[model samples]
Target: MSGETTNETWEEIVVRVLKANEVSLVTYVPDNVLSRLIRLIEADPFFTVVAPAREEEAVAIVTGAYMAGKRGIALMQTSGFATIVNALASLACPFQIPLLLMISERGTLGEFQQGQAIVCRTMRPVLQSLGIEHFAIQERAHVEFVVDGMVRQAFATQAPAALILSPLLTKRAA
Candidate 1:
């Protein structure tokens, strides 16, 4: 595999792009696909990582961090996206807090769980309804450009944004 022409692993690219965008506070509810990025983010002294009991807490944590003049993001799975709607609507949106969401797309692309499927089906519409912008990342090539652009746009406009990490990108265990 040494001289392989394989796509870059999503976690490594995501972490590098995040650091370039100056992200400092990171919060997550924990997902298998996101674990690799979490470890990298935790290891960097520039970042402060928090594992909240729920997804909504991650949203709130980033919102506060944003107000305090820090760049922040939340990483979670599609299922956890279901739990953060209220927090995003009530806190993040109306207040215009800039947040970057890195979500591992579950329930689509060969998902085994019915719950994940339902959440996956609704995640985009939910984000749209909240006036949050989202972009899908299925190729490694799109990571740095799309993520960097979205994060810059989000903070510049002081609004929430999402980057949907497709199963094809994560290549994770179902």
Candidate 2:
């Protein structure tokens, strides 16, 4: 299924794409922006959801899971993403682990928090500097395609890929 139905939410589409890609392990650091996605992933028996104390830990967990012959993903908000830069650069990238990351975009579109806004601007540049493949999903219509393709390419190339969930898609913009 392409998950093109109007009734299917972006969160549901994400779960479906993850399952279709055989990504059975879900690691995350709790965040309000990603709560719905995490809840859906946890409720599904197909996924083994792990909530770590920090985003960096989630990255390490997914990397370890991948080493054990499992496909995994790390979900977190933009602020949490700031904590994982070192882990992503030193561990995931150098080790060639296809650590999947799903980040909820914040600090944009009338954001109230100055800290979030600052980090948001640096996110894309950091990803580019590290040569990590990243895509932003601003609309539900393109979620499945971008997610599936990123998953496939990440594993195939043995490199990490990021999926940024834009507020426009989540309907949380300002």
Candidate 3:
């Protein structure tokens, strides 16, 4: 076997990668695109999923979990990620927390919402300005390699890393 997934959806691939890496806590604000992954994470006893009213709360929740010696991942949309810029800068980055951010991309090509498109344009620069390393998981074929590698590196450096899920890769979610 090549260890490549065919029938498995990208969301499933994400769940598997997180589980394989022992990511126990998942914090997020509601995102329609991430609902599938959220549901899967919720079903597993190994994962403790938390939904906060706002994205910054999700950041705080994950930060607390990280300080307590638990691995956590924050899942949200691009707009949601924008909301956590301060938290990511003042808290996560300065603290050197190994946070895994899975942001579903918006405000890009084929995006329907004006707000989403606006945020999309700024997503990369926002991440760069904060010195956070981010990558796009824009193809299903690259999910395992890119996600597994990114997750490993985030923990290795004890820094925040993000995987931006492109609408191109997940039309259903988009």
Q: Which numbered prediction scores highest in TM-score against the true structure? A: 2
Q: By lDDT, highest first, what's the ranking? A: 2, 3, 1
Q: Alpha-carbon error at 142 in model 1, in Å? A: 0.8
Off by over 4 Å in 2: 172-174
The best candidate by lDDT is 2
Tens-digit lDDT track for model 2 on 1-174? 644457888888888889999999999887787888888988899999888788888999999999999999999989888888899889999999999999999999879999999999989998999999999999888888899999999999999999998888886532
Which ranges in model 1 have alpha carbons more than 4 Å from their true place? 1-8, 172-174
As for TM-score, the candidate ahead, 1 or 2, is 2
Ranking by TM-score: 2, 3, 1
Task: Give the per-residue lDDT digits (tens) of candidate 3, residues 1-174.
Answer: 148688888888888888888888999876788888888888889999888899888888988988899999988998888888889889999999988888998788788889888878888998999999999877888999998899899989999999999888877453
TM-score per candidate, in order? 0.91, 0.95, 0.94
Question: Measured by C-alpha RMSD in angstroms, how accurate is candidate 2?
Answer: 1.7
Cα lDDT listed for each candidate: 0.84, 0.90, 0.87
